[model samples]
Target chain A: MAFTKGAGPHQRGLTIGVDIGGTKVAAGVVTPAGRVLARVRTETPHKSKSPKVVEDTIAGVVEELRRDYTVGAVGVGAAGFVDDQRATVLFAPHLAWRNEPLRDALKARLDLPVVVENDANAAAWAEMCAGAGRNADDVIVVNLGTGIGGAVVIGGVLRRGRHGLGGEFGHMTIVPDGHRCECGNRGCWEQYASGNALTREARELTQAESPVARGLAQAVGGDPALITGPLVTELAQKGDRACAELLEDAGTWLGIGLANLAAAFDPELFIIGGGVSEAGDLLLEPARKAFRRTLTGRGYRPEAEIVAAALGNEAGLIGAADLARDALPRWRQGRRQRRLSRSRESRRAF
Target chain B: MAFTKGAGPHQRGLTIGVDIGGTKVAAGVVTPAGRVLARVRTETPHKSKSPKVVEDTIAGVVEELRRDYTVGAVGVGAAGFVDDQRATVLFAPHLAWRNEPLRDALKARLDLPVVVENDANAAAWAEMCAGAGRNADDVIVVNLGTGIGGAVVIGGVLRRGRHGLGGEFGHMTIVPDGHRCECGNRGCWEQYASGNALTREARELTQAESPVARGLAQAVGGDPALITGPLVTELAQKGDRACAELLEDAGTWLGIGLANLAAAFDPELFIIGGGVSEAGDLLLEPARKAFRRTLTGRGYRPEAEIVAAALGNEAGLIGAADLARDALPRWRQGRRQRRLSRSRESRRAF
Candidate 1:
């Protein structure tokens, strides 16, 4: 609350960062160094499921944290497509944000400058600025949550493509006719490599009463529906062979997906984040092996290093705050120009 | 050779561009407007199977074109990876050049500033500057020849990633275990969607003696091994049903690969060039269809236009020349700094 460790009077002011997911709203007052000074969390209020309700929930969290610190700006990392200007949410699958003007609404309600970004992009920027990708000029972040999301950082700048919809790596087809995806595409990379893929595969194995999943089924109380990604990860961490094998299978697919990304981006490093990445080498080793095998020009070209995310779950909030803080100077420059132009109008009237 | 019509005297001097493939060497004297002032072609001297033999052939073509035009610089677009400095050929699959210092060799041999570039990159740049992607801020070029090759142009500059290898779209895996690729990967997009794929499919049909391939086999004089990509293209152009269907299938795969690229890059336009691209609408319509169907966030996001290359084969040569001409200023800057540093060294000696 008192600015993590040290806060001199001359120090730069803090900014609030909000990570809005489907189930939770995690907000924090972040320092310029990406330290979370104070934080508040709340259920997403999905029962209301309205844009106003969501904004009010986010505002409530900001209000609680701002009381403990002097804040400069607010940045929200939303699980949706943010406009090129970072002013609106084009669409979010779990939120009632269909082309919602969330930024303007929040700015008006809180009387603070606001900037919004795609959640994955915010996380990637956080890694580049403060986490594993620090000092790396070109990096790609593949966040393997229930779905796979990605962000590209080139020359240390976040690349939001032509329409602010670049990093949708999960949906890239990996097995042309392989598995059906919620995105309505068949054989999406996420369908085979993400947390959902692991849970689905495990669930199917248990449902079919496969011998390999005997221990997993027992841990899930004999209910195939009770199987979850985290349960499988926990089981794998505890040295469960079936769960480990499942992770390895998913890891192989993940590696192939990474190879495809490498073919296009040729980044120096890849940062793996999201929920499933918690499996660690249990998931990455197989991926790396497959990547080496599948990478084009395997022996000739340099391969990108694949590593886990350093900021963990806090990356989104931290990145959001920093992005807002970075945009502050430009926003102020714009305000000054408007004020100067207004004064010129007044002088002309005189 | 004279400048193209309307090129004023104050315009930049012409430069020579050479497109060196495994089988042919195409060279041109190009003006600042991306117009070819003069051109010459010769068979590649792969009989000697030496890098120097290839260089001498390139030099022979450049020397021939230079005699007719007053050139400023020379640019060679080789079918390989060009280093970040644009001064070395890191590796070429077709030519016997592995980490060859072709630029310095050419500069020494010709006494002119020389720049080497990846052929796909050169073609993409040409399209951006003068062809299909003219005035477009962001563009992706997919060249579907013997295999697929790609380049990304963001803003106005070509993007060469961390190690000067970014746009090898042909190698991106579209199907997990669909087909074996020459790069040793299975189910690469090129394996399913390139000219080789088309020719292979047609050849297979003829080899198996399918009734649909009757016309194609007859066109190839009943020799399945005689089937080439152009032969299939020509048959399709003449309204051959089986040949048309093969192109359509390959186009669909091409479209899927393009969708994967869109997910990563989000370029505003995609220019499809290369030898197989000559199939025109016969190839593009199906690709566009598959692209629309497989594209992530299909209805919500703006789709990139997939079109044909207007400059055709000359794009490589013209773009190479333009790249060399552009590098001339920077090359001169380095020389000037060297001269100034040498003077300071003499001063230190005194």
Candidate 2:
């Protein structure tokens, strides 16, 4: 197996990073320093129940990229739970994958080493390494996409839980018996603090054809489900008073949840990313206010900075490729060392 | 500095550990193995505003125990925020201590090395070393006292946060705009799941003169304010249905908060300690049930064990002394090494 400490001037080999979303597969040939040197995009075979079609699409993307660049390894960040070994996709709600060994399959087919990771974890790592969370030992990345996805880093190490299921921030039950969530729970933080929440609130108001939501209702032809988070964000950014107000309300909920996170993790920095965070201060201003107001022992402790992710939508692709290039070898080495030590102890016992 | 890796047969020196609570000061001479050789207790000079009064009381207890054992060092676990250096008490709500240099003052007067720590951190360390969390690399100790207190260890290192205020678990907001908390927030976890919360519920029931609280009201002579957490625990243990129901409520809240924690830290074990934990499974069973139900991605992740602390109330004193004997020197050495490396780097630049 190829081993490199990190990105060095002489060892700047390229790696392919693939982000498999619900609708599309976005692939990029990322430089060792996390720069996307080249890119490719293809629609996901979403209708296929078989995992083969999706794997084939990923392999095709890698082969297409391999034609242009001498890639070392491939990192695929899936919107689902990745196992601790970074070798399997345990589950993906939108994709036709469950307990899928995507890494080994891709490795065998593409003839390149592969690593898999949860998309949010990849994004957070990108921010920590080459974006807003640079130089901070502890960081939390709140990816405010369709749902409020999260990733945590403590003491410069990603804190994947005992079963590699840590950073499920969106599903944390913030309010008991409150709003119903898709995850069979009530009052989950995401239910009240995400893109879907913002759209849901705005869409609800449009049903009344109220003066505040008149423009939104017209834009979506009076269909509440047709309203997207980005449309609301665009409307808010264009100085639409009602959309801004809606964003403010969602931001406040975001801030309250962030305060709860502050009380628990005490991170040095919080990087806000994803489609919703693109609204910038429209979403963050109220969040900042709520975070300060709700933070426990606010006056006594130093407050962590809440900033937008610098890498934008490219975070997952960049972070995944970098992890494949840098972290994968070290992780494999550590696992081998543990296994070797255990065998040595067992031999001594005999 | 006398440096020791950890407790071992070769380093069998005794240390004096003092636990300064709101009502009293408890002191103990503890061996390297965490055995309390001699114990002392004294009423706190609560009325005295002078720091000297408390310092003198602590010294008196140490002197009394010194007559019985040959001690090497002293450790004091203050029921408040200890600075990152573990040398000063920043601000204790219950005690008259604000930026008090307790370690230096004790070291000067006692002529022995002294280490100070947050009482909850001390207890958690004790549990990690000698009790329920023994052999666990990652652990979370939820100390349920008047309010909730917390300590976390991850990857074999105590997570003290960037500002030495990491384990403030009591303040995590579970209910948005619910009950008003003393921390100027509404619906803090401690407001719902603590000894104070238990007593407050019982008192409110007594105020209504309800049939359910009739036995508890009679236990305190009908004076609701006179009802303490221990009194309620005793009543519940003796088969008071109302008191047991109250405990169940608190346990449920505790479990919800634990689930939230699992989303964040995901430790392998959670050692429940402090005075209220003495109720054992009466409090824990409900907590465990709630923990499983509320846990995010429950079936997908490994459940952390929720066990009672074995060292009991003596945890604070014993842990503090052991930390003084073992962790202090290592911490000091680390600081010294960092300082040396920084200076060396600067010198090399010239």
Candidate 3:
């Protein structure tokens, strides 16, 4: 870990950001400039069916990072619905968390000021502050992973909506009774436009033993189950016609969904992030074409620019740390006020 | 005109609100409580092919209203894209308004403070302040008319988006390649769920002379051309199963779109307004059911309440008047400052 020394007065101390995903817990000591000084990673105890186990895992990573660098606070980005107060995880689909007070639990164990946020929101904030959305005040960050995750930023503020469930763009129905989603709905946008969609279509083609999918079949050794989103993307990047066509199909779906978002949000820009975005223009070109064709009042209105996110997978942790840093002054002031009130009460009792 | 005598200090004076539509121009003198004190209606000069004709019509209505009531300012709610500054009509599909400086034109002609806004945005602001969305902090108003129009209010402020074109919900593509829309898009939500959709379907059924169309055909005197959205709604209200089925289908589409909005906005309430909304439970019951079924994180998240709008057609004008009133103080101060600056410049010249 190479630490950038003397990060100016405003930059102050470092903060640790933990990204708690369904499969792994990744933590990093992030500077004010969104640079990571040190990092630690561990597998999520999702199989344990204990929220405490996940909390313990997050604490362990923070402790590991803190051993080397003195951090001011910890920010945890969980892949779940976080409360507006950013104190509890309301529910996580792949984790054993049901109304879990993760922030309080982590703060108690780590003995530091902590903030909790939805992973998508964290990533969006990171992008807005340091990446592709740096100059845009109104942006929508779309994360094209297994399923789609989204965060909306308007007027430079992250909009969590009334219930902190805003920006669940993937679940918006694109086709009526089209494809059944894991969320028990039919025709979700993600079912057609996400990484899962990309891989699912490729796998189905290979499974059918289609001549068009021969290259993909041979790459995965004729095992359809071995086909993955990244494998298809890699093949496409290597100039595989079949893989490129599949990506084009997904890109088309992606554009249609983005046009729908434009109607609803009319954002200035859309930052496309997540793992699948690594395909770059191979994915964005088709999406952009579809968006232009499908956008409402295309010529009459200023169309929002759709671009790839600059930050990689580390955006979530970086944003979480930045958010925690932004909240630090208030958190410290609150703690000081509480201590003063407690002392006054004790004096009165004496 | 019945004036509530001795209104409180805060409710001093009256303001005029003008609603410009494709077919008609409606203006009203509104009290601070969102009440219409007086009204005047005239056909829109859409055939003139001149933006000045529309401005003249707006000015004529304001002058007529001013004769009966002493209005301090005027607000015009145009059915087009209003700029973020509320000064220009960027575009109106129905009217000859392309980059029309409507506010300055109206201000010059009427010699009163003027504010121009999107009609749907004006209606949404009205609902948020004094109608169905009253007491709600976050609201989305869906106007189900010939086509759907929408406005979003978040944290009690109307969000007009980066380019003041945020709520074009009618144009969002619902079906991949279903119905062709007049807006040059295929499968727009309005093509499936709006007033035009209802009438078009009813006309199709009647034109095909199907057994299910007998009742509707008889009602429209065996002419499919006479079929209208309101006619079908009325028949459905009188217990016409075929007409009821049509409304139910439209309602289902409405609910699905609402569910999609919930995923993106998570507003506290969705106030349904416009012509088709008069169908009441005939349209809303099925829509609510579809919304509940299609909403993402259905069991975990708080669902926004979908309800009929409180104010009727007068909502646009009422909201416009209220918005004008809200901007009155600032407008007055600006004029005063300008006058002061002008006098200072003259003194310096002397």
Candidate 4:
């Protein structure tokens, strides 16, 4: 096995990064540290949705960017799960792929190296590398979009868990017998904290003609259907009572869920991202207050800072590229086979 | 800082282990691989009454055991919340130790190398070293005793959270508006799946004169006060319907709780210990079944093995001593005051 040296003036000054979203395929040429040198995007074709075409689209984007900048190995970050090998998109919810050999196929077709990874994991890494989580050894990312997303990095190494299916922060059971979750569970943390859930709560409040809904009703033209996550965040920023309450509710739930996560995984910082986080202090102020209130041993331990994600939408691409740059010898997401050491004990404390 | 080597020929013969329980203190000389050599027991004395007298009583038991065997370093597992320094007991519900420097105090008094640890973490380490969790890198210990005790081991090392409060599994809310817990939280995991809960449910069944409570009432002589976690387990083993049903209910909840932990930490093995674990397969069978049913990704990943714990009562002492054998470096648990490494740029993954 050969190891490629990272970030040297040896060859090119650019690395190819691919961000495979639910609706579009975006690719960019990233600098050694993390700046986007050049970007190219294309509509994700809706053909047989042949996994082949998806690979081709990624190659096409990289190919176009390479024409403008000298690109090295490629990194692709997709919405669904990526296998441990860091070269396969094992399953994608919005994309048509099942146990698909993405990186290997791309490597074979393009004669260039490639790696694939989960979008959230990639995004978190990007934040750590050059964004909000920089200089932190332990960091957590909570993406509050359509659904909530979570990722953890401990001692600077991303904890991929036993299987790639490790960091499902959205699915944590927060409310018992409260709301039915999509994953066949009841009252998941996401059901109470995600952007979709925020909209749901806002709609309910508007339908009931609550006292705080007047400002929100004026913005949405008296239609409850107009109350979306983005609109609510907009109204909250403008100091609408109903919108502020919805954001506060989201923040409180987010805080409690985060505290629970902190109890399990002792992270030092949390980077909040996604569409819902655009309200900034409107969402963050309540999140910070409630996190302290619900935290175990509240005043004892050093608290994890809850901050906004710095890299914004570009994290997934950068993280994917970085993951590819450091693929393990036998790396498969769930099947990370380590040489089982028989207790060669060390007093390595944490 | 000096560290002890892994158990080799040196610790093969015998090492004294001490468990400071709520009601009693148990001590014994144990072999490296986990067999008790010479054992002694005494009632756990109250400190308010006479803290020095209680210390003297502990010393008497230690001296009694020392007379029969060549013991190595001593390990004491206390039932309480330990501090990050590992030398102090912050707060113990059953014992009178508030910010008390336990290890150093005991070491000075006993004139023996002493190590002190939280009882649950110690029990977990004992299980990993000599019991059900052998050869596992990540493990979770669920002790279903009076309340609930939890311990998490990641990469074969005990994961002490930011405040030395990593495994507070018992306190996580399983139900938002359920029963009130002793910790001032409602519907904690302990409230539904522990020895106390088991006994409560069994006693209720017997009092209700239900079909499953027939054997339980007979065993307890139709007296509700006679019902206990152990008696219920015993009756369940004897094929009693009501008692068995109660254990099964508790075990199913245990499985659900275990599943939640598994989802959060992604451990490869779960070792179930404590007094209630004595119910054996009568409880474990149901727990295993429920865990499989409720696990997040049922058919996606490798299922974690749920098994019984080893070391029995002496596990806590053995594990604590073993932890002491490998001394904790002060820096491991503290924030490093160092800047970014000069070699970090070179170590970057492009």
Q: How much lDDT does candidate 1 score?
A: 0.84
TM-score of every candidate: 0.92, 0.89, 0.92, 0.85
Backbone collisions counted per model: 0, 0, 0, 6
Candidate 4's C-alpha runs over 4 A off are A1-14, A42-48, A209-211, A298-303, A328-347, B1-14, B47-60, B68-72, B207-214, B328-350
In candidate 3, list every pair of residues with a backbone clash: none
List model 2 lDDT by residue over B144-229, tens digit each: 99888889776555667655677889988898887888789999999988899988998999989999999999999989999999
Candidate 3: which stretches are off by over 4 Å?
Answer: A8-13, A330-350, B7-13, B330-350
Q: List the residue pairs that clash in candidate 4.
A: A83-A333, A84-A332, A84-A333, A85-A331, A85-A332, B212-B242
lDDT of 2 by residue, A1-350 (tens): 12335533233467788988778888888765566777889998875558999998999998998776777788998888777788888877778787899989998998878888889988888887678876676788999988888888776666676556678888888889988887677888998889989988998888877898877887888898899899998888887888999999989999998888887778778899988999899999999999999998777667888898899888888878877764345533211112223323432111
Q: CAPRI band of model 3?
A: acceptable
**Per-residue lDDT for A165-255 in model 1, tens only?**
8899999988878899988889999999999999999999999898989999999889999999999999999998999999999999999
On a 0 to 100 scale, what is the lDDT of residue A204 in model 1? 95
B121: Cα error in model 4, Å: 1.3
Each prediction's interface RMSD?
10.9, 8.2, 11.3, 3.6
Worst 10 residues of 3 chain A by lDDT: A332-341
TM-score of 1: 0.92
Q: Which ten contiguous residues of candidate 1 chain A have the minimum total lDDT?
A: A332-341
* Candidate 1 error regions (>4 Å): A1-3, A8-10, A330-350, B1-3, B6-11, B330-350
DockQ of each: 0.37, 0.30, 0.38, 0.31
Q: TM-score (chain A) of candidate 3?
A: 0.92
